[model samples]
Target: AQSVTQLDSHVSVSEGTPVLLRCNYSSSYSPSLFWYVQHPNKGLQLLLKYTSAATLVKGINGFEAEFKKSETSFHLTKPSAHMSDAAEYFCVVRGTSGGYQKVTFGTGTKLQVIP
Candidate 1:
């Protein structure tokens, strides 16, 4: 079974400060991990992905995540938080179940940017 855990339900950061959204995942086999961001009244957008290629993956809008198998962690980070960055983030894990592809999602973390 594959599962994802987002350590924080809500993360508040200053407009110009660094942002960190913690996530941890478990899978029976090597899995694909992803981070998605959803703005208000908008669909989820793919931020970054780790597909066993590189440990560090960069995505749109200055976001990036590092896949650490030793720690079973895939945390999202941004150097500077923008007001536009405020949104709900989801950590996802993709694996196989019953020979079919399945994806497990985290509870989601809401990011709040403070001016």
Candidate 2:
């Protein structure tokens, strides 16, 4: 079984500042992890993913994350926050459930950008 936990339910950042969203996860074996972002009244967008190939993965909109096996953590970060970055983010984990693969999403982190 695999699961993901988002450490923060909400994150507020000033425009032009840095952004950070924390997450941790567990899996029975090597798993596929992903981060997805959603704007208000919009569809989910893929941010980044780690499939056990590279540790540091880059994504769109100047966001990136590192997959640390020892820490069981996958944290998302952006050097500078943009006003458009305000949204809700989900940390997802892919694992096996019974005989089928399952994808689990965290509670989500709502990012509020303060002008």
Candidate 3:
């Protein structure tokens, strides 16, 4: 069975502070991991992806994640959080067996920004 657990359901930070959203995954095979950010009523934007490539992957908006096979973790991090960064984030894993790529999203982590 494949599953993912987000360490936090909600994260609140003031503008300019560091941000960390933790995630751990379990898979039967080599998994493709992704992090997506969605603004209210907007579509998901891919932040980063890990597909047997570099262990440390950087994405847009100064966000990055390190794929740790041993730890079975792919935690998203940013040096600083912006006010615009307030949104919902979902950790996703692509399914292997299905013909169409089925992306399973984590429950979600809502980011709250304080002025």
Candidate 4:
């Protein structure tokens, strides 16, 4: 089993600047990691995943994240901020626990778009 932490409870960015959202994870084994976003009153949508394939994983809406095993981090980044990007983002870690698979989600980071 593994756990994840979303460093910031809320992050604010202007319309066009770079956006950085931090996340850290703990796992006994190589974990299957994923990032998901939830818009206001909307269901969660899968952003990207690290399935032991690529360190740099890209998602929809110009979002991407890098998996750093050495640091136990999987921080999400965007080149530019967008008004539509305002949402609650979650970092999820999935692994086996007690011989059964389990999933854990980080405390969500709420992205606020400012003018």
Best-matching candidate per TM-score: 1
- Candidate 1, residue 106: Cα displacement in angstroms equals 0.5
Q: Write the residue-wise lDDT of candidate 2 on 24-106 in tens digits.
A: 99999888999999999999999999967799999999999999999999999999999999999999999887989999999
Tens-place lDDT per residue, model 3, 2-53, is 7888889999998889999989988777889999999999999999999786
Alpha carbon lDDT of each predicted model: 0.96, 0.95, 0.89, 0.95
Ranking by TM-score: 1, 4, 2, 3
In order, what is each prediction's RMSD in angstroms? 0.6, 0.8, 1.5, 0.7
Q: Model 2: runs farther than 4 Å from truth? A: none
Supply the TM-score for candidate 4: 0.98
Question: How well is each residue in 1-115 modelled by candidate 4, as lDDT tens digits?
Answer: 5899999999999999999999999999889999999999999999999977889998899999999999999999999999999999999999999999999999999999997
lDDT of 1: 0.96
Best candidate per lDDT, number? 1
Q: What TM-score would you give candidate 1 relative to the actual structure?
A: 0.98
Q: Output the lDDT of residue 8, model 2.
A: 94
What's the lDDT for residue 53 in model 1? Answer: 83
